[model samples]
Target chain A: MAGDAGSIPELDQKKYDADEQVKIICLGDSAVGKSKLMERFLMDEYRPQQLSTYALTLYKHTATVGNKTVAVDFWDTAGQERFQSMHPSYYHKAHACIMVFDVQRKITYKNLANWYKELREYRPEVPCCVVANKIDADLKVTQRSFNFGKKQGLPFYFVSAADGTNVVKMFREMIKRAVDYKQNPGDFMDEVMQELENFDLEKKEDNSEADEDGLKAESPDLV
Target chain B: MSFEAKRCGVQFSPPSIVLIYEHKETKTIRKRIIPVRNFSKYSDYSMAAERLKNHPRHRDYLEGVSQSQLEKLHIILRDHMQGFSLERSLASFNLDPDEDLNKLDDEELARKKGQMDELFEKNRRHKDDPDFVYDLEMDFSKTTQEKCSWDEESDDGF
Candidate 1:
């Protein structure tokens, strides 16, 4: 393990059993504090997730859902900001989604529709959470209601990664919902995904290696 | 299930490559704003273009688009991010080779240099070409009365 990875905790080797692997993807415009939220949730302090070797880091967060530890892969594709419509693979088989927007930037909040629209295009039924980030910048805004999440009937959160307010609560609830979806999907989307992959595409498969290979093959653009 | 590329454009506010296409199955017109990540004013337009074209997930959707077309959009995005006006950037399309590149700002000069490099690559002849000759030579007509600063011969400079 690298020195920096130590400061960021890892699942205990002795008890690490990824019986249920869940992928939680974060979607937002450029500089919307998506990484900051993930960093804050993973570690005590918010440290910008680095991509020195593996492009963007997929945080392996170990969470307990119903007494069974579930290994969750937190997706924060930092430089993957090329399109308002994200790559479908970004939502491919994703269990849950975190849609974030910078509270200070109104445009980011306005663009949530495009992000959510694209999210539904691929994964129509995944549990999604809408986050109003950077509350520390102006805590007063939290008192106001953002109707995007309410209209869509998705869970909405007011989080501040900087001062660490409501970050834990938001992530914990997201994990629980994702695990619930995995155990008992509300509709046929899960079955369709399984049919498409033709595999269980479930807990036993360790996606770390598969994803690492994918990143390794991704060369510097224009090369 | 398939998308046909109708047109492509650049979005400056968020630095995105907007692709307008029609869903072949649904017959719906859709816009996919592909976000340009980790890009800056100093980012290489061609490289950025290639990166977007070859992005692991994005490449599949961008397959129908042309590389040159994508490069042009990236150039425009880079120019806008560098604070160049739309007119000024568009004006580069019809570059006057005789224009004084020295008078241009650093960003403009760099862009012009990039254009020159691309042009040079297009016209460059290699030894393996059909017209390749080992003893290729040409004679140039001398200027009438031009005496540029570099023309002066002095012992001080090599």
Candidate 2:
């Protein structure tokens, strides 16, 4: 028994040495305060206005979850309607998602289904949180938003990006969930892993010549 | 899924070469991919090759590459580097002599100048004030009406 225990792989030790990385993506319709919410959480300051993101915006943050230091990569997408049809490569290796909808605009709320559909297609089992942003403006659609969250079986939060309400708590919860997902990855993540395997196989077939270099250079456009 | 819905209509090509080089200071192995398309520009190829060669830590990686492979890569790079200029020469070979090359009228040019000035002023204001907020009252009113029909058909309008 002692010999067998000694031969067991030290997975936890390896994970601790290699700081875990988690990719969190923010998705929503245009003008739904996705950028504002991210900026407020990252900077801890209320940005009254934000420029519409054209491409992907990355925010790297390190946080201590449990006993491990996890590096969180937050990908904020351009909420413009034209950019809604995102490339599949954007969803590769994502751990979690925060889908936001504006409380004031009913259109933004209705567009949640479309955004969720896109996320599910690429990463079916990744944990997602529904955020109803700009709650400082109005509360009329509160019940409807709550119902939507319940229907999706996702954790929901009524956040005010302008007032810095519940932003920290929401992000903390996201980090915790991401850490849990990474540690076990259970049956839910099986499909995601299989899809990733298929993608890797396709990538290998595409770059047979470059295999000798042992360096995989990603395009700036993909980044 | 339907055929139209299943297809994204976008094709992406993978990078050609992966260069594994050690960092001079950290001694950490860094992987960089050099795409075939980037070789089209002579300056881009020269700069990339020069940086890789000058780095002290990349000596071992460069030395490990076979002489034949290196020569092959150089030939491909040279072809790509010259390809752009060759295409440019071919494009200008048959120029339409009767076409109106300069088409802008004086009034149109002045209007464009006014638009540019307005954009410059707006940009200056944005630069000066970090907390500048755009007037969203009209947009709010338009989007928040009881029967607000969100325009889902046209993506370019916003």
Please provide, for model 1 over B10-38, each residue's C-alpha lDDT reduced to its tens digit, 9 standing for 90 to 100.
88978899999888989999999999998
Chain A TM-score by candidate, in order: 0.71, 0.69
Candidate 2 lDDT by residue in tens digits, A80-124: 344455554445556788988766556666667777766655555
Distance from true location, Cα of B7 in model 1, Å = 49
Q: Which CAPRI category fits model 1?
A: incorrect
Give candidate 2's whole-model lDDT.
Answer: 0.51
Residue-level error in angstroms, candidate 1, position B49: 27
lDDT score of residue A58 within candidate 2: 64
Q: What TM-score would you report for chain A in candidate 2?
A: 0.69
Per-candidate iRMSD? 30.9, 15.0
Clashing pairs in 2: A215-B18, A217-B33
- Model 2 Cα lDDT, one tens digit per residue, B104-125: 3332222222332222222222
